[model samples]
Target: MDVRFRYSDHLVGLIEDAAVAATRIATAPVSSLAAEALRAKRDAGRLSARLDASPLDDATADAVDAGSWARPAEERWLDEAAGEGWLGEPAGRRLDEALGGRVTGEPAGDAAAAQPADGWATALKLDGMPTQQVAAVEYANLLACYDAESELTDQLFEAPMTVLTTLHGLICRGLVAAEILGRPRRTIQAVHDGAQGRVIFNTPDPRVVPRLLDGLVDWLGATGPAGSAGLPTLVVAGVVHERLLEWQPFEAGNGRLARAAARLVLRARGLDPAAVAVPERTLAADPGGYHNEVAATVHRRGDLGPWLEW
Candidate 1:
């Protein structure tokens, strides 16, 4: 039976904090601090922070970080996606049209219509899903991330700005791939067992994704947002992002899917959908760290904590 009715309203404030934190960190300049020092400084922990003993405080650090996070280090791909602003227009208009339609399950009102009309629109849909259907060991995988958050907001908390609903209800648009839209990858499996998998870098097999996500959904459904032992929203989002990438559910577009989910969680939790502070920017900048941490989750410890910290 479904056990998603037990969620809490506390996630709202937690998510808001995370969204703000992600946005601020994403926009910051490359810190001159040593790598470890940088990590220590950015983490929200106070005791851990005292170890660094830097004069930097949260607000000042944010200003300093955002002020120069991109001025140094890899300056090349910083605005890469910014150029692709291609999706901006299409996503906005779709938000408007869908809202205008006011479909019960879709976004509505002036906010949807307010999205900027000037954007280089691009078609966002899935065409040829593999002709051979990958039979579901189970189909609950379809709702994967969305279902998790949707239940949190709708079943447990207020119905507004949920996983399925968001700024302008824009989430109504093509938030994910077409064929596999919101499901977990039944075909994706871990490349190896936790033991050997750690020694080598085999991309996780997609086969087990469905089972893993199903278990995850069940856990979230049963216990609710308070279930993760009171993990911060951003940490939770980070775990979701890292695990999804490792799962690589879709035959294609896994990265986009993962980042989309991350962005949504941030927005759903109150990151100001209009804000450009996406964690993807941070990961994109630190690919090495991203890869290593993600690897550690499945490989080294099979624990998501490391990835969340990353």
Candidate 2:
């Protein structure tokens, strides 16, 4: 159940170019104020694309659109985080902020009177807003906070699972049943292409899920910046994305979590620490290509050059 992949010289060269671009995107001579604003826009675009990638009914999409009124609150939250120097703090403190309801949103209709103390309980004050809207808004906030964490540390590599579960927990807060929240799947899992109406692949046995994840984290730490021989950040990001998608650890939100984690890798590995990169938008733009690449990797048993190249 160890992590595995193969790539060519062409892939290596392409990833090298990507690594340079990623590094420059964050390090270029942009003012901090402008960078923060640009990051906010990037987050919104990425979050919107991610939601669009999921299978949503028209009603849900419309509801989520109505919920977009919370954008002001989201901006305010990001502003506060940036101003308060919350970016490089430990991931646990960020998780605490999420668990404390600070990252949740109130109903858009009630936004004008929103108080700092309202927190998640105000989500119950959604009035007529669909709960789905709350989920979407919460996701937007959680992802922004996650991406804003720019500091890389050895702790992250040593216990990558902590970050993954924390993210899964944030994502599934109200979307999934409580018992399964943040927990690895205990039963068999299969990935189905609802758009194409076919099974893409079956996951490893649940018993192996934990071991496979351990292998992934170990590989990540070994080949990532924490290790002596680090691969290109973009290459590591691609492997993180595909492997997490292949594992199917959580019953829900696996795709979202994988993308978020991949972006984290980009940030942690010095490619896009500012996290303005919207790679998910590229994947979301062509869902068919993304799925096909993943399916091909699954069938080929960790042959990831095609996915990486794509």
Candidate 3:
């Protein structure tokens, strides 16, 4: 007997209803709503990527290498920024001020005075842990790194690896959180053992990877016009996240990779990539729903609305 389930229509209707409800709420400024949505998308993407255990295809591999290869020069500039106190201690103080003393202990009397002005700089190191926790830490670390730097160019080269690694981590974290597997890293292994829906899309083909990276870079570099122009940013992030999942890229970490890539895009577009203070944590709290949303998109050939709405 062959059995198949159809949940796309049901899920899409539910998402549309929620979006309608949100639209009816107190009129939210377009810029503000776009910013928040971008952040949430990034968070979800990071979580998803960190959990998958897939490997990189040749195209993706080249992109990752190119991005990483480009980093040394940027790193030197970053080091200079740090040395000039542009992105070092002074920047830290500025961040604290901008965060409204959230980073520091005192209130910043004005937004302008709080603007990290130079740039935000931070270094994050995650200790070893079982695969799942590692995934979460990776996502958390990426958020920290992205938030620290004010200029996207500084992270241009490292973007691909950052995206892939973070995605791997998030998937692991999600599996552990859901108790779908006792060990975080072992979720893929367990799935394989059970023959429970093979990841179905794991490869390092040279054909698709480069296109993905280039598309991501182009989106990051594209500019928006004045007054409430964050829609493009959110749309690009949503597209990238969905695309990576559709590509599958790795044997086990595709979901996590997609999420991490989304976070990178958000940060590159000058948006906060952290999930800590936003609605993302609330969304992630429901692992089953989160997985279902992603699955819906993947199965539907990347329809995006259901995943993006959730």
Candidate 4:
């Protein structure tokens, strides 16, 4: 069944206000601050991604031994897809570059030089080179996100599973085992409220995830092409964010994926085409409030009115 969601009069008004703002933003002329604002927004996104990986602490949750995690997943499909020129030229090039050293079966550049005692530490800065080697998986995530943004065409929106899996594969490349990359989580998953130190909720059985995702795709279809039509941009963005989080489709990197997907919705929908607005900035500012709102929405059985308003 499609997840339940309710719309209120207040929610409708809020969406309308957001729509008006989106129109103004879409029509506004480029300003000197656009570049700077975009840069700031990107930085915020990176920080938010890091925080999502490690909500309560700066320590990396997905960190593994450098030896085990250093070698990229040498998947044949990746190279084959790259050779087939899938998802356009830029995306293909990025895919090739992401698997460059591994595909050649030789160390390349700094990845060769940085011989740490342990495995790579992804999600943030490597404070000490002696202990933590930078993971190429992180670089893959950067390229993947950039490519996803560029490839957000109507066709992509029509069948978004490709982009979603690509994002998951790149984001969780070395951080997880190769077999699980681009795969829906098979095991049970539980998310805890870091601040409260209590289990907020447990994800549904993995068997149902595919069905839930299909429902999400259907909802996206109703939202229209590029996920920008029919509904207000912010409403679409919010639903995308919450549903992904609620589903917990991947074993890891779900938080980052959710945020990234929401950003794509915003950009594709013209709410933040210039990427000036930093939703993460506000989210990171009020971590407690953010968690509370999400928890509240989930507790309400996916009634997203409060979440959209928030």
- Per-candidate Cα lDDT values, in order, are 0.37, 0.58, 0.39, 0.59
Number of clashes in model 4?
4
Q: Over the stretch 147-206, how does candidate 2's per-residue lDDT look in tens digits? A: 444532334565677667656655555554444545565555567676676777777666
CA RMSD (A), model 1:
16.3
Candidate 4, lDDT over the whole model: 0.59
Candidate 4 structure quality by residue, lDDT tens digits, 1-310 = 2434457888878777767876777777778447655565445545565446432222221332122334333423354455444456665555535544221112112212322212222222334432323333453354445444645544446656656666665566555655455555555666777766677766666657767776676677665443435666777788888888877776677877787778777777666666666677778777667767777877898888788877
Residue range 36-90, candidate 1, lDDT tens digits: 3334323422211222122234553454335432222222221232232212444
Report each candidate's C-alpha RMSD, comma-separated, in the order given: 16.3, 10.1, 17.2, 9.9
Clashing pairs in 4: 65-119, 66-118, 66-119, 66-120
* Alpha-carbon TM-score of each model against the true structure: 0.41, 0.69, 0.39, 0.69
Candidate 1 local Cα displacement, residue 62, angstroms: 29
lDDT of 1 at 238: 64
Model 3 lDDT, full chain set: 0.39
Q: In angstroms, what RMSD does candidate 4 have relative to the true structure?
A: 9.9
Query: Sort by TM-score, best first: what order?
Result: 2, 4, 1, 3
For TM-score, candidate 1 versus 2, the one ahead is: 2
